[model samples]
Target: MLILYTYSFAHMFKTSSFLMISSTEIGKYIRNMGMVCFVCSLLLIIFPTCGYAAINTSSTLSIGHTLSSPNDFYELGFFSPNNSRNLYVGIWFKNVDPRVAVWVANRDTPVTTSTANLTLRSNGSLILVDGKQDAIWSAGEAFTSNKCHAELLDTGNFVVIDDVSRTNIWQSFENLGNTMLPQSSVAYDIPGGKNRVLTSWKNDTDPSPGEFTLEITPQVPPQGLIRRGSVPYWRGGPWANTRFSGIPGIDASYVSPFTVVQDVEKGTASFSYSQLRNYKLSYVTLTSEGKMKILWSDGKNWTLHFEAPSSSCDLYGACGPFGLCLRTSTPKCVCLKGFVPKFDDEWKKGNWTSGCVRRTQLSCQANSSTKTYGRDTDVFYRMTNVKTPDLHQLVSFMNDKQCYEGCLGNCSCTAFAYISGIGCLVWNGELVDTVQYLTNGEVLSIRLASSELAGSSRTKIVVGITVSLSIFVILVFAAYMFWRYRAKQKEPTLGVVDTSQDAWKNDFAPREISGINFVEMHTIRTATDDFSSSNKLGQGGFGPVYKGKLPDGKEIAVKRLSSSSGQGTEEFRNEITLISKLQHRNLVKLLGCCVKGEEKLLIYEFLENKSLDVFLFDPTLKFEIDWQMRFNIIQGIARGLLYLHRDSRLRVIHRDLKVSNILLDEKMIPKISDFGLARMFQGTHFQDNTRRVVGTLGYMSPEYAWSGVFSEKSDIYSFGVLLLEIISGEKISRFIYGE
Candidate 1:
C-alpha cells in the first residue's frame, strides 16, 4: 500500500504540469480554456487585432467581449455612445485623431446592456442581437447572401459583398449620414421620385438630420441650390460654359483632381473628389449654419478648402432684381445704367429690397397697329463685365452666334449671353441677384428702347459728320497750296517722305504709336485709389509703385510717375510706346497706359513673388532662390534678350537690366521689366549711339562708361553682370562700393 501511494503521487505531479494545473489554480485553467475557445470563435465580431484569431462568417462574436484583426488595423465590438449606457455595433479608425467613427449599425436603436451579441451568421449576414435573443439590427437580405462577406476597406468605406462574385451588395455611400467622404455624393438618387439626401448633423455631437438640404434644380441651365426649410438660401449659379459661375474661386484655388458628373438622360449630377496622394484626406460637410463647405484633413483637424456663401455676392438676391451688387461699393447695390431704384427714398436709406425699375417704359408692344408712332423699336445695350442673371433656359441646336441671332430675332428676348464651354444661356424675365466680380468673366446684353438707341446714335453721327467735313476742307486747301508751291520746294512735298527724312521730321514730336490700349487718368486714379498711401507696394527713382486690381480681377502694378521724379512724362511715354509692342515670356506684359490730368500710370501685370532683390538680398528670403530657380532666372534673361535683339520686329535694347527690374510671378517665373531707359533700333541695326550716359554705375560696361555710345551689345554686357549677380546672390553696386 505504501509503494502504491508513492507511484500515484508521482503520476499526479506529472499530469498536473501537462494540464498546467496547480493545487489552487486547477479551476482557473479549466475556466480559461473555455474562455479562449469562446474568444477564438467570436473573433469575426470585433475589429482585427494581433491577439485575436482569424475569423470569417463561420465565427461569431458577442458583447462583454471583443476581437481584433490580425494586423491590428481594425477592431470590432459592442460600443456605447457618449453618456449613453446602451451598447452599439460600430466601426472606427483604429489609429486616428478623434477616433473617426465610420459606420454605425444601430444608431437609433441601441442595446440596453452588454448582453448584445454581434454575430456573422452562416447565411453571411451580420446580426446584432440583444440579451433577450432579439435581433436589434441585421444586414437585411434583399439579395441572396449565399456567398457574402463584409470587409472594412482601407479607404474607410465598409463594403458588403458576395465572396465568389466579388459583387458589392451594399456600400456605406448608399446610406450617407453627415460627413461626405471623398468619392461620396451629397446629392441623392430619387427613388419612386423621392430623393435621398445627406442632411447635416443637428450639432457636431448629434448625427440626426437637420433643416438644410442641397440638390440640383432642373432649371433651364440646371443649377445647384441649397435650401433651408424649403426656402432658397444659396444658389451656385447656373453652370456656365465650364463650371458654376458662383464658384469661381474653386477653379482658381484647387490644385487637386476632381470631376463633376452630370447625366442629362438620367437627370442626375454628382461631384466627386479624388487624390493621387494617400495622405490628402478630402471631405465635404454642410455646416449647421446652412453653409456648404468642402474640407480636407491632414492627419489633424479639418481645414476649410472651399466654402460657398463666402462673399456678399453669394447671398441670394441681396441686391434685388435689375440691380447690380458691388461688394466694394458703399451700399452694395446700384440701378443698372438705364434703370432707377423703384423706391428712391428707401434705397437712399439703405433699403433696396424693392429693386430697380426701367427709366424709360417699354414701347415696343404698345401700339401693334401703328408700327411708327407709338411703336418704338426695341434695342439691346452692351453691358460689359456683368454677371448674367439667374433662371435661364438652355436652347440646343444653337451655337453662340445662333443663340445670339435667335435672341436678337425675338422682340421679347430681354438679355442673352453665350458661354463657349457651356453653350448658350438666355434670360427673358427680370434680372435678379446680379453682382459684379473683381474677376468678372461674363458679358451680358440688356434690352432697351429704340428711342434711347436712336438718340445716342444721332449725336454720334452728327459729331462724326462735322469732324469729317472739317478734315476734308483742310485737306483740299493744303493740296491746292502744295500744288501751287511745288516748283519752289526741294522735293514733292505732298507724297510720302523717305524713311530717313520721316524720322528727322517727326523727331521733335511725341510720336504716335498704336497697339497700346490707353487707360484714362480717371480709371487709373480709381484703380490706385487716388494714389493712396495704403496701395504703395514699393518705391524707386521712377516713382512709388502701387498694387491695384482691375474690375476684371487682373492684378496690376501701377508705376505712378511722381512730379519731382527724375523720369519725366516724355520718358514715361517713350517707355510705354516701346514696351507695349514687345511681347516675350520673360518680359512682363504691359496691359495699358494712362497720361491724363498730370497722372502718368503704367499698368503692368502684378508679380506676387516680387523682384529678385526682395528675395536675394534678405537672409530670411534668400534661401528660397535655390540653384534651380536661379538657373531659370539666368536662362529666362537669355531668352528674353534673344527676342529683343534678334527675334522681335524692332531690334530693342533694354538699357537697364538690374535685380530690382526682374519681377517674379507667383510660380517664381522671371519677368524682365523696366523699359524706362530702353531704346529701339530700326532696320538691320547692330549698333547705335546715345548721348545720355544713363544707367546704374556698376552695370555699365567700360566702353559705354567712358563714351556716350550704346547698342544692343551694351545691353548684353549689362545682362551678363546681372547674371553673375543672380548666381552669387550679391548686388554689383554693393560689391563694388561697400554699404
Candidate 2:
C-alpha cells in the first residue's frame, strides 16, 4: 500500500502544474466567450439601432427625432420654436445660427402633445399624427407603391418616394413653405387652378401662416409680388429685359440667376431665383412684417443680399393713390403736377395716405359733358424717373409714342408706361404706388385736362431752367472725366511694363517704378491649369502659390493675391514696384504680374525644392535636410536680408521674414519671397512707426510687436529665432517653457 501511495503522489505532483495552467486558460477563454456573447445579445436585444439612422425612422419619425440631408446642410425634424410647448415638424439649416425654420409640415396644425409622430402611410402618403394616431396634417396625395420612403435632399427639399420604382410622389418644393430655396419656385398652374406661394410664418416663434405671401404674377413677363392678405403690399415692378424696373441695381451687368418660364398657351408661369456661387446656400424669406428678403448663407449666419421695403418710400402706396413717394424729398410724399392732396391738413401733417385728386377731370371721362366746356382735350402729362403705378392692363403697342396715343384714346386709361421687355402698361382708374426714384425708375404719363398743363406754365419754365443747369454741370463733369481717361490711355497703365518690342523705357509716373512685365490674366490661367489642386504648392497669409508651366515651356510659380486678406492693392503695387527694381541671387525673382479686376497675381521663377519649411518641419522629410544643408539655408537667408538692408539701391525692410517665406531651389539654395509687407527707406532713415501692426508673431522683435515700431534690428531678431529653430529642430511656437 505504501508503494502504491508513493507512485500516486509522484504522478499527482507531475500533472498538478499542467492541470492548473489548463484550468486557468480554460476559465479565461470561457469568460471571454461569455462576455462576447453577452455583449452581442445586449446589443441585439437592448440597443436595436438598425432602425435608427442618425435619428430613427423606418415608417415613422417620432417626436424628438430628425432626418438629415445627404450633405448634412439641412435637417427635417420636430422642434418647438423659441422653446415653446407646441412641437412642429420642420426643415432648417443644420449648422446655421438663428435656427430659422425653412419649411414646416404642420404649420397650421401644431402638435400640442409630446406623443406625436410624422409617419408614412401604407398608401404612400405622409401624415403627422397625434398620440392617438389621429392625423394632424396629411400630404393629401397618394402614390401606387407597396413600400415607400422619405428623403431630405441636399437642396433642402424633403421628398417622399416609391422605394420600388424610386419615383418621387411628393416634394416639399411642390408645396412650398415660407422660404424659397434654390430649387423652389413661385408658380401658378392653370389646369388644376393651383398656385404655389410662400406664406410667411406669423412670427419668429409661431409657424402659423401670416398675412404676407410672396407670389409670381401670372401676366406676360411675370413679376414677383408680396401681398398683405388679398391686397398687394409691394410689387417688384414689371420685369424689364433683365431686371425689375424698380430694382434696377441688379441689372444686366450683374450675372443674375433668375429664370421666368412662361407658357402662354397653357397659361402657366414660374419665377425662381438662384445663386450660382459654388456651395453657397441662399434662400428668399418673406417675414410677417411684409418684408421680402434674400438671405445668403455666410458660414454660421445669413447675410442679407437684398430686402424689399428697405425705406419708407419702398413701402407700397406710402403716399397712397395718385401721390408720389420721393426718396430725396424731406417729407417723401408729394402730389402730381396737375393734382392736389385730398386732405390738405392731413398732407401737412405727413399723413399722405389720403392720396390726391386731379385739379380738373379728363374731358373725355367727365361726369357731365358740361365739365369739358372750359377744359381742352385730355392730354398725357409726362413724369420721368418714377416707379410706374400698379394694376396695369398690358396692351400691345409698338413704341412709346404709340403707347401714349393708345392711353390718350382710351377714356378709362388714367396712366401709362412702356417697358422694354413688357410692351405697354396702361392703367385704368386711379394710379397707385407711384414712386419718384433718385437713381432707378421708368417714365409714367398721367392723363389730365389740357387746361391744367396750360395753367402750369411758370412751374414748367422754372423746372426747365433747373434741368438745363443740371445738364450743363453733368456735361462739364463728363468732359473732365474723358480728358483724364484720354491722358491715362496714352501710357500703358503706369508701372505696368509692356513686354512688346516698343516697350516704355522710362515712361512710368510712379515714384518707385523701374520696370516690370505685365502678363495677361488668360496666359496665367492657362499656365496654372485654372489653379487646380494638383498645381497648388502652398498657401500664405496673402493667398495660394501655384506651380505653373508657361507657353515658353518655362516653369513658374504664381502667387495669387487674396482680396480679403490684410494685404491689399497697396501691398500688391508695393511688391511689384520694389521687386521689379530688386535683383539678387538670394532674392526670389519676379518674372511679371497680372491684374484682372479684383484678382492680383505675381509670377516668379518656379523653384523645384519648394519652400524650406517643407524640408525643415516635415516629420519624414526633415531628416532629408542635414546639418550642412540647414546651415547653408541660414547663410543664404542672412545674405538676402543683408542685401535688402544695405546692399540694394532701395533699403527694403522685409517685415514678414520667416522660415516659411524662404523658398529653396533645385540646388537646395534658399531664396527670400513674399515682399508684400516690405517697407522701403531712404538715406538716414533708421526705423519707422505704424498704427497697423502687421507681420508674423514670435519672429517679431518685442519693441515691434508691442509698440508698432520696426527697424533693421527687427529683422535681426527674427533671424536669431529662425537660426535657433533650424539648429534645435523645434519651432519657437512649439517650445514648452515650464516654470
Candidate 3:
C-alpha cells in the first residue's frame, strides 16, 4: 500500500523533480517524515485524481462542480448568465476577467433548479439532467463502449470521446454559440443547403439566439453575410484574392488572415480566421447589437481589432435604390448622377429610404417608335470608387466593352459593373444599396438618356468657355501692364519689383491637378473653430498645424503657412503641386488645399500617433518603438523613397528627410510627409543644382549641403541617418554631439 501510494504521488505531479525519486526511495522518505508527510503525499495524489480534466462513465459533475482543462486554460461548469437565476453548462476562458463564455451546452434550455448534473452515461453519451431527472441536453449517438468520457480541451472545445479508440464523438466547437475561436470555421454546405452559423445573443445578459444571424453565403465565390430575419443587414461582399471586395479596411497585413475554403466537388465553403500570433487570445463574436466584432486579449483586457457594420452606411440599403451613401457627407445619403430625390422634403429631413428617380426617361424603350433598332440612344455615366449595387446577374465570357454593349442592348438593364475577379455583373432592377467609397471601390456604369448626357456636356462646355474668357482678359491686361513697365524701365531712377495680384498670379498659377479638393477658407475656418489655440497641434518651418473637425466629423490636420515664415508662397505651392499627384500607402495623403488671402492651408489626414520625432525624443514613448516596429518603419520609409525615386510617374527628390517628417498612424505605420522641399525631375534628369540648400542641418547630405547638388542618393543618405536615429532612439544631432 505504501509503494502504491508513492507511485500514485509520482504520477499525479509528473514533474522532473518528482520523477527522479524511485518508489522505494519515496516510501523510505515518507516513513522518515512520519504520518504528516504520508498524509500530505496521499492528499496530493488523491486531490488531482478527484478533480480530473475528463469525466469517465462512473463520474458525474453536479451543480457548482467544474471541470478544468489540463493546462487550466479553460473551464467547463454550470454558469448563470448576467442577472439570470437559471443555470447552463458552458465552457469559458479560465484566465479572463468577466468570464468570457465561448460555448454553451444548454443556451436555449436553461435549468431552473440548482440540483442539475452533467454526467457521462453508460452508453458513452454525455447528458445534462435537471433536478427533475429530465435530460436538458445530450451529445447524440454515443459510442457502444462503456469506457467513454467527456473532456474539456485547452482549445476551449468540450468533447465526448471514446477512451478505447481515443476518438472524439462530439465537440462543442461543432455547435457554435456566438463566438468563433481561432481555427474554428463557419461552414456552409451549398449542395445540402445547410450551414453552421453564428447567431447573436438576445441581449448582453441572455444567451438565447437573437434576431441577427451571421453566415457565409453560398454564392459562386462565397462571401460572409449578416442577416436580420430574412433580409441582409450587412454583406461581406464577394471574395477577392486576399480579402472581401467590400471591406478595404481588412488589409493583407491584418492580425487575423481570413481564408475561405471552397470545395467544388463537395459544394462546401467555410470561412475561418488563422491567427498569426498564437500567444494572443482572439475571438470573432456576433454581438447583441447585430455587429460582428473581432476582439483580442492582451492578458489584461480585450481590445477590439475590427468590427463590421461599423458605420451608418454599412447598413444594407440605408440609401435605398438609385441612392449613393457617402459616410464623409453631411447627409450621408445622396442620389446618383442624373437622378433626383423621390421625396425632396423627406430627403431633406434625412429620410433616404424612398431613394430617387431618373430626371429624364430613356428613349431606347421598345414602345418608343422614334428609337432606332440598331442604335441605342442611351449613354452610360461612369461612376468610380463605388460599391456595386445588390442583385447583380453575372454574365460570363464577356469583356468590359462587350458587357457595356450587352447592357445598352437591353432597355431593362439599369447599370453594369465589371469586377476584375468576377465577370460582368449586370443589374436589371433598380440599383439598391450603392455606396461611394473614398478609395478602393469598383467602377459602376449607369445607363442614362441622351438628353441627360447632353445637359452634362453643355454645362462642361459653358464652364470651359467662361474660364477661357477670364484667362484671355487677364492675359491682355497683363500684356498692357508689362508694355508700360518696359517703357518706364528706360527712364526709371530706382527699380520697382512687381508684387501685385498679377505678379502673384504669374508666380502661383493653378495647375490642372485631379483627385484634390479646393477647400473654401470659410469652411476651413469654421472647422478649426477660427484657429483657436487649443486646436493648434504644433508649429513647423512653414507654419502652425491645427486639428480641425469637418462638418461630416472627419478629423483633419490643417497646416497653415505663416506670412512671416521664410518659406511662403513657393514652398506652399511646391507642396500642393508635388504631393497632390503622388499616391502611395507609405506617403501621407493630402486631402485638399485652401488658398484664401494670406492663409495658405494644406489639409492632411489626421494621424493620431503624430510624428516619429515626438516618440523617439521622449524617454517614456521610446519603448513603444521596439526592434520589430523600428524595422517595419525603416522598410516603409524605404518603400516610400523608392516610389519617389523610380516607381511614381514623376521622378522626385524629397530634400527634407528627417525623423520629424516621418508621421505614424494609429497602427504605428509610418507615412512620409512634408513635400514642401520636394523637387520634381523631368525624364532622365537625375541630379539638380540649387543655390538655396533647404533642409534640416543634421539630415542634409554632404553633397547637397556643400555643393548644392541634389539627387535621389541625397534622400537615401538622409534616410540612413533617420534609420540609425529610429533604431537607437536618438536624434541625429544628439548622436553627432555624443560622438
Best by lDDT: 3
Report the C-alpha lDDT of model 1 over 443-527, residue by residue, as the tens digit: 6777777666666677889978988998998799668757756744666444322223222223334444444567766677777
Cα lDDT, model 2, residue 508: 45
Whole-model alpha-carbon lDDT for candidate 2:
0.78
- Leading candidate by TM-score: 3
Model 2, 1-739: lDDT tens digits are 0000001124434566766677778799779979987885665444322222222124567765567776677877788898988889999888788887889999998988769877777777888899977889988767666676677878888887887788888888998878888878999998879899999889888879999998889866677888999988888787765567676444322335666788878989888887644337788889888998888776666777788877788778889889988877453899987889999999999999989998887678734434343234877787866778777788889877898877776677788888655778999888888888754366688888887876667888898998999899879966876786777779876533232212222334545553467788889999999999999988888799899999989999999887567788678877888887665668888988877656778899899998877777889989988887888788888878887898665788898888898899887888898898899998789799898989888999999999999999999998898898888778879967779
Clashes of 2: 0
Please write out the lDDT profile of model 3 over residues 1-739, one tens digit for every residue.
Answer: 1111122333555688888999999998778769877786677445533333577776777776678877787788888887578788888887788778888888888999869888888887888899999999887776687777778877778888887888988788788989988768899887787789999888876888989999988775677899998899998776654567677454222223677877757989998886634345778889888899888787678878779998888899998789999856453999998999999999999999999998998877645454353155689999866777777777774578899888777777789887655768888869988888876567799988877767677798997899899999989988988987887788747444454433444565455344667788888999999999999999888889999999999999999988676887778878878897776668998999886656678999999999999999998988877887888789888888887998666899999999889899997888899999999998788999999989999889999999999999999999989988888787777634443
Segments of candidate 2 deviating more than 4 angstroms: 1-58, 251-254, 276-279, 329-331, 364-378, 456-739
Decoy 3 TM-score against native: 0.71
Model 1 segments more than 4 A misplaced: 1-141, 186-196, 218-221, 248-258, 276-279, 319-323, 329-361, 364-376, 384-387, 396-401, 451-739
lDDT of 3 at 257: 65
TM-score of each: 0.56, 0.55, 0.71
lDDT of each: 0.67, 0.78, 0.80
Q: Evaluate residue 663 in candidate 2 and report its C-alpha lDDT on the 0 to 100 scale.
A: 90
